[model samples]
Each structure stands twice: as C-alpha cells, then as structure tokens.
Target: MPVSPAYRPDPRFFDLGPDYADAVKAAEFPKHILRHRNDRAAAEVGLETLSDAEWIAHLGRFEPLPGQPGPIAMRYHGHQFRTYNPDLGDGRGFLAAQMRQVDASVDRPQATSARGASDRLRLMDLGTKGSGTTPWSRMGDGRLTLKGGVREVLAAAMLEAQGVPTSRALSLVETGEALERGDEPSPTRSAVLVRLSHSHVRFGTFQRAAYHQRADQIETLVEHVRALYHPQVQPGDAPGLLAAIVEASARLTARWIAAGFVHGVLNTDNLNVTGESFDYGPWRFLPHYEPGFTAAYFDQFGLYAFARQPEAVFWNLTQLAGCLKLVADAGPLTDALNGFGPAYIRHLRTAFLDRLGVKSLGEAADQRLVDTTLALLRDKGEAVRWEPLFFDWFGGFSSSARALSGPRGKVWQGEAFDAFRFALFEHEPECPERLENPVFARPDPEEMLIDEVEAIWAAIDADDDWSIFKSKLARIEAARTGYGLG
Candidate 1:
C-alpha cells in the first residue's frame, strides 16, 4: 500500500465509545467491478496513488486503511416524513475510516499560524453505502441498487459544481448481485458507494440521546461535536452549537433553492450536523421553477416540495433544539432556532446572486433582483428551464446579448421578463472572466433532469455502455470550472 504523506488517519469517532456505534465487517460480494472512482477526492485524503486493484481491495472489499480500524455502524434514530422512527439507523452502511485532509478553501500563508493549520485541514470521513448489513439491518438485505449509486454520484457532482456544500461520492464499485426493489425494475444490479464528507454526526445523533433520557450523553455529544467541528463555541455552550448548525443549515437550504434541487428526503438523519448534504435518496433538480414539484413519489402531501423545503428545514432545526433542551435552557435554544428565518432570507439573497454571477449593488437592490428573478421564473411556467436562465444570463447585463439570442431567447423577449431584465441590468458581473469558459458558449447548459438521468442509466443497463455517464460527468466538471462559483 503506497499511501501518500497527506494521509493522516484520525478515527476520532471511536472516542465517543461503544454506545455510539458497533464494529462491523463488510459483506463478501461475488464481484468488485469499479464503476466510478473520484481521483480528485482521493487526492484530498492522500489515497489517489492507489492502483485500481488496490482501490478495489480497500474501498470495494472494505480493507481497513493502515492504522485504521474496521468499519463501525453508527446508531441513531430519526423522523421519516415527520414520523418518529426509533429503528432508523445505518442499516446498510458504516463509518469505514476517518482522516485529515487539506481544506482547499484555506490560504497556504495563513495555514502556518498556530490555529491556522488546524483550520486549514478538516477531518473527513469515508462512509459506505450498500456495503453490507449491520446490527440495524432489521431483516432487510443491506444492498444499494446500481442505479441508486449512479444517481447519487451524479447528484453529488452537480451539487458541488453549483457551489452547494455537499458530500463527495468518492467511489462506486459494482458488486455482482441481483436484488429486487419495488421502486425500480426487478433484479436490478447492485453496487457499493463510498462518500467523503466533513462529518457523519447527524441531527438524529442528538435526538437519540434525548430519546433515551440520557442527558449526560447529550452533554458529552455536545462537547465532542464542539471540540471537532465548532471549536469557537465554549465547552458548555449547547445553545451556541445549535446556533452554528442553524446558520449552516439555513445557508445550505438557500443554496439548494438556488440550485433548483429538491432533496427528496430532508430527514434528520439525512442532514448532518455540519450542514453538508449527504445520503441523497430520490433527489431531483428542477426542470422548471415549480414550487409544488416534488422528487419522491411517496411524498403524497408534498411536505418536502421545492417551496416547502425552507419550512421543512426550520422544522428539523426545532427538533434538534428539542434535543438540546435536555442539557441547555429552552429560552436560548428557542432563540437560536428563531434565527433560521432571518438567516435563510439573507442566505437566499446571497445564493441567488452568486448563481446569477452578478455583483450585489446593495442589500435592497439584491433583494429586488432575487425577488424579480423568482417572480419571472414563476411567471414563465414550463416555457423556460431553470438552469438555462442562469446559464444564459450569467454575469448579468454583460451576457445580455448572448442571453437574448440563446435558445430560450423567445421566452426572455416576452413582457413577463421586463422587470427581471431591469433588475438584472442594475448590477455588474462579479467574475467577467468566467464568461470566456467554453461551457458558457454551448447552446444549452448541462442539466441533470430526471429524463436525462434515466437515459444515462439506460445506456449503462442496456449495453453496459458508460460513455453517456462519463461524458455527462466531464461536461459537469467543465461547467463547474466555467462557473467558478466557489
């Protein structure tokens, strides 16, 4: 195993003791065909140098990294569709490994300072999906459909490109198995997915402690989270911890709105304490701006619809606050929970502006731009696609000529966009140079609509042809580079 120097294993979650998780073994599969490998993410954790065989041996077969212990199945309970489920846990996956990785957002110069090094490097986790069954399997087979893995990989890539804080799909290995899933075609293929994320500590982690009436465990959990993720907060400041999560989660929700993403399930377990999106199940990117559009077929009431996402997130925050009440004052927790509305509004403004690639004229003007843009999108109905509107008008008025002549030009020419056009022209482009990227020159933007996703999977399923999937990923990478939204 030729591991890079950047590989620094730190299995910190084990410090929480046996109550939080149980050590588990990966299931033996018949095959280990590599479907996708994220070399970019591998480099971050110093595993990029591994050969395909080595990669399969480690990620596919779940061989523990050097100095790393076996996989640990984390335990927690969460609300599924607002219904409390005590049996919910990592039924199919486990926290395989933990390590420190360079935070690319930090400046190298500042990294030399005493506090800078720690800030520059973040603790990342390698968590598995469809790897195997665990104590929490509950009589169900621990398997992930191949289509599910592909969808998640695509979702993670597009979300990252859109500057949304999300987990990176590190690896996907097709295991030789046939599984029957009611939602999809019978006897579908199976694969194991590995995700690289900031932390696996979910909102449900705290809920579990509170549910058990273990206030002492809640207190310890608070300390552990604050020490690793939010060091700025005082040791006993549980309310402050809740506030940090609230702010991050608010910003994340706003980003999802700007990206036209409907996270089909916004369950407490799906949302980590770090506010980074992960465990994507039945996620969808909007084709058009429709508030009532939903991603999951089972969401009969549209509780987590496109427009209702903000409300759903706020509700989840209150759940977390309820758990915090076990160790902290209710007044402070409620105050922190109340911050979601204001924080969401502020973040929505920033997120929309960033997506539009425009500089904010001022708070008032920016709000108008956001408001008018959404109004125009709503007005246009199905006549316009969501991503192309941003793609065409990126950099505001600077790209007006291009936007007016693009494929959606006819829609833009209508009277409905008059106010939106005026609002957009009021601001200048933030990164004018990004307009030169070849991705923006194309007639259409790269989109991950449901139809396109099905097409890509169809190619793979019918003929084992991965060209469409690979090409789409390449286009997404190009778009990510061109947008330069980060």
Candidate 2:
C-alpha cells in the first residue's frame, strides 16, 4: 500500500506501556513479529519504521500512548445470521487506542462530515481478536485460528487490489499456541489486530439499545458516529441524521454487489454503522454467472447469497429504522426507508462503471455491451476465469479485441472469442493456447470454501516465493483487460 501523509494516534485515548509480552501471548497474536525471521516481509509492510522497543511497546500490549487515554471495552449487541441475539458485544476486543490527526484518505471525513474541510477525526476500537473473552463471547472461545488470520489478510489485500473498499489489516502475529480445531496438525492459533477506519459500532449496537428501551444510549451512540463519520448532520434532527446514515449504509452495501462480493453473514451485529465493511468471514467473490452463489456453509436457504446481498442490506437498514423510531420521529424516517432502493441502484451504477475505468456511459445505448459480455462469459462457463478479462482490458494492457464486433468483423477468425487475442497490446500471451482458449476450459460447479482457499495460500506461503502468485496476477490482469475492466 502507498503511504499517505504522516499520521498520529489520539493521545487522549491511548497509553503506550511496557508489559506487552504477556498481553501479546494472552491475546494469542502470532509471535512471528517477535521472531523477525522474515525481516524483509515485516519491513515491506511498514514495521521496519518502528524501533524494536517501539514495536514491542505499541503492538504487544493494549497500552495507551502519551496524550492518549487508557483502553476500554466497548458495548455493543448483534444478531447472528438474522436471529435476534441481544447479548453480543466486545467479547474479546477492546478499544486499544485511537489514531489521531491522520491525512489518510480513509480518515478523510465523508462529505456529510466535512463541514469545515477539516479531514481527520478520532476513530478508535482497534479490535484485538483472540484476546481472551471479555463481556460478549457467550459459550464460544475467544481464540481465533491461524488459518483464519491468514485468510483475513489475503482477503483484505486481494480485495483492496481489486479496488474494493474495505478495512485494512495493520498487523498479524503468530501466537505460539496449540489449540486443536480441525484439518491442521497441531491446530495452531494466532492473533490478528487490525487498524480499521471505523470499529465496534454495528446495527446490532443500535438494536440492542433500542430493544432494551435505552433511548439515551442509542442517541449517544448515534451522535458519536455522526460526529465521527457523518459530521455534517445536526444531532437535533433525529430523522435527518437517521436518513443520512441509512443512505450511507445502503450505498456501501451496493458497492459490495458491484464487486461481486458476498458477506455470507449479514446479521445486525455484523453491519457497521460507519458504512465500512467489517467482520470478514465466509466471504467470496463470484466466479461464475450464478446469482444465487453463497459463501457460507450454514446458509442452506441462501439468505445472503450474491444476488440477495442488496435486499439483505436493506433489511438490516429497516432494523436501523426501527431503532430510529425510538427517537419518536417517524415521518422523514419513513421517506428515507422508501428511498433505499433507488439510491442503491444509482450508487451501484457509479461504482461498477468506475471499475471499468470509464468516465461515463454514452446515450448511443450499448445495451448489447453488457448482454454480450455476460453471454460470452456464461457460454465460456468460467466465472473465475472471467475476472482476468476485466483486469487486462481495463488496465489498458490488452488491445487485440479492440476491433471486435466492428463493421470490419472480418477480423473474427472462429466462433469462440480468443481470450489471448487481447494480449497483442503487450506481447503474445505467454500461457499455452489451450489454456488461453475459451473452448477447452469448462466451468465446473465449483464453490470456494475458506479451507480450500487456505490450502492454496498455504502452498504459496510455504514456498516463500511469490513468482507463481505474481504470474497468476498477471494472467488475471490480462483476462480483466480482455473484459474491458483491468
């Protein structure tokens, strides 16, 4: 990731301390950083800037820094997969410290929040996953699997590379613990604490308060999010404030669809009020034309399938509306709820077209463009393979198909569109023709699971060489370019 302007953590909310070794172990974060075996890898990700002592002090313990306040466990409640569960909150996670005065784009206040053009604000609750249970775990363990950490890291990086707006991982550690789960030998577990643009507040956060009739807490939380994320809104106007948040949430969820991502779990608790993507679990990008693709094993009914994500988001927003009703201003609130469908569709169009690297769509009406592309991909029957076409074409790395479907259609050589034809913009596509040709590849009814994906990455991580991965990325870029969306 490219470095933004120098940023500082909020001193009032954090206190940096020394007794972090035990806390690190207790949190089950990987000791890999302490081991420093791959100093190169560590440095590649900005850890090299920290002195050894600073590294231990900042990351090891949940300590506050100078001018920063001490840590506190945040209060929240969430629904698990649509079932109303009011007892969930920061079971193991806590607000470690706040990153104050940053000029990072994610830190930039949303248009609703930038009244004075002052960009930075306080965003806390840097969640420490695998920290031993606090107030919320219920019957479950607070520990997370090492494989889970790896999967999250991969998901964040890959999604960001694909231009998906998401929470970025700050640090991942290999806590030297042997907790038996499944599939692995020792079932080693680890900790991955992330630096999120927003944290700890969820739709369940509001739902919990509203359910218990704690209108004050609900109002307080809403004010805090508005100040931090939607600063432009006046707190006194409860209905308008609720409307802005609803619109933001709806639009954020629409981007998920534009990118073909499935959250797999859309519980009220998992939905962040800050309009940021959080809680990565059982998430998958579509690999084929099937709109009903689901990433979660437990979703037998496809409650949160790829196509259903839009509706799921609106459903969650309705729960938000119910919570807003507690404020006793239901007039404008109803209008906002009714506006979700149209607003979501508008945002989806903007985001997906932007991904194609197009400035705007023309009025000459290229309806066939979308239809033909989908048909080609469906006929080719390789959804995962279809991604490469966009990567290459949109990146301006391929041009072989530039004349395709033109009046001089004589350039067409065969019935099937040659995937490698676009590669002429760079050099001859290096992969074998059989592999590049759309005919030989058949789409199987394949659905990628977390474990299956981990196995693939395990091989890559085990080898410690990224040439293969890099080549694979290049192939994907070529394919994306072919699809006019690299």
- Which candidate leads the pack in lDDT? 1
What's the CA error at residue 253 for candidate 1, in Å? 0.2
Candidate 2 minimal-lDDT segment of 10 residues: 13-22
Task: Score each candidate by Cα lDDT.
Answer: 0.90, 0.55
Q: Give the per-residue lDDT of model 1 (tens digit) for 73-157.
A: 9989999899998997889999999887855464422211223345436889999999899999998799999999999999999
The lDDT, on a scale of 0 to 1, for candidate 2 is 0.55
Backbone clash count, each prediction separately: 0, 48
What is residue 406's positional error in candidate 1, in angstroms?
A: 1.3
Residue 419 error for model 2, in Å?
A: 17
Off-target runs (Cα >4 Å) in candidate 1 are 103-120
Stretches off by above 4 angstroms in model 2 are 1-7, 11-48, 104-125, 182-186, 362-379, 383-386, 395-452, 460-486
The candidate 1 region of ten consecutive residues with least summed lDDT is 107-116
